[model samples]
Target: MSSKVIHAIYTDDDLLMQAVKQTREANYHIEEVYTPFPVHGLDKAMGLAPTRLAITSFLYGLVGLSVAISMMNFIMIQDWPQDIGGKPSFSFLENLPAFVPIMFELTVFFAAHLMVITFYMRSKLWPFKQAENPDVRTTDDHFLMEVSVGKHNVKDMSKFLSDTGALEVNLINK
Candidate 1:
């Protein structure tokens, strides 16, 4: 099935931000936004719900910390129990200072790596996936806001977007 989408092009990020706010106030459903660089607070301006990636990252870090603790306990306390430089490893708590570096490093490693994987998976991005960019200019120095045209006058929407500082507006059927 074919539907209509409006692509409003803006030259400035500030203009795009204002347009997004105004569009939301007018109750238009914004489909997507493409910008050359990250815009501050654009997600909130678009009324998008907060992401839960931070929670996932915290959980991953906890898992990493626990793994590090168990590994260090088994290695330095139970398995070998080395007596390096007279700093005996008889108890895990007494020798915890030696395990701090490994624990910190492993926690950071797991959090960063797992967060990357989770973000890519959640965004459905991977090698060989086709791009869905609507305009090439948006990758360079332009910003594009895609809004769905559902039961609204195309001319009015185009004019409204233009008045909101769009350099150009194009109607796409997909």
Candidate 2:
């Protein structure tokens, strides 16, 4: 199914951005970009939308809170009753101080665990899944540009890479 991937490596972020602009100007489709560090405005430059993970985390946190409150209510009121704190143990609203800790724990638990699960699912990643990085060096000190050449000559792409200050270029076959 034509699993052709090409990468161009640049030394500096400015040069990499120039290359990206040139690629856009020439109407080349970019597959992905890898940088050694987070670059501000890069997502906007690439026209990528913001992730909605925060919203998912909030919803999960709410679910956890509800579960914790329901469980506490059932245990303290219906299942067993004990009047140790000299407060109304049957009515949770009368003694919310004790239930606060459990509620907080549940909220944190749900936010962390569920958010991680959602991230993994959204990224299509699972345990023991091999990484899909184009170049191992890109994770360290290099900036990588992955582009797909369609209806364009490879020679032209090579020329473009050279003009964009690419120190190295390579093709990956999957």
Candidate 3:
């Protein structure tokens, strides 16, 4: 069965937040919200679950640290032991202090690069992807809230959204 949706456009972020809260309180399902910039606390306002990107970043950093340690051990100790400034070329642990910079740099590099890749994959933001925003204005200076109209009265929803400071309300079928 085809479903109907209500698109509420708000000019202000504050008003959008208030509308989202009111909509949630009134038992409406918010499908999504598109804004020009990231709206602080908008996820919480929409009752979304917290993200787990930090955990992934930590894992990526650990991988990078492991690679750095192994690479440094192979190159410095096993492959060709170096005698810089007459330092002892004995153990990996003994020369770990010198590899601290490489370890730190690799950790940060992997964490940053992998986190960005993970974010892009999670958000389905691949290169050359078409924009999925319903309203072009939302890309510039508007905030759009998409409310699913499952068993909800469209007229009442439109009126309620307008009352909640929506500048415009439009119905879409899908």
For this target, which candidate reaches the highest TM-score against the unseen true structure? 3
Query: Per-residue lDDT tens digits of candidate 3, residues 1-174?
Result: 788999999999999999999999999999999999999999999999999999999999999999999998888899988788999677998887889999999999999999999999999999999989899999899999999999988999999999999999999997
* Candidate 1 to truth, TM: 0.93
lDDT of each: 0.95, 0.86, 0.95
Worst 10 residues of 1 by lDDT: 92-101
TM-score per model over all chains: 0.93, 0.88, 0.96
- Candidates in order: C-alpha RMSD to true structure: 1.4, 1.9, 1.1
Residue pairs in candidate 2 whose N, alpha carbon or C atoms collide under 3 angstroms: none
Q: Write the number of the candidate with greater lDDT, choosing between 2 and 3.
A: 3
* Per-residue accuracy of model 1 over 107-139 as CA lDDT, tens digit each: 999998999999999999998999888999989
What's the residue-level lDDT of 44 in candidate 1? 100
**How far is 80's C-alpha from truth in model 3 (Å)?**
1.2
Off by over 4 Å in 3: none
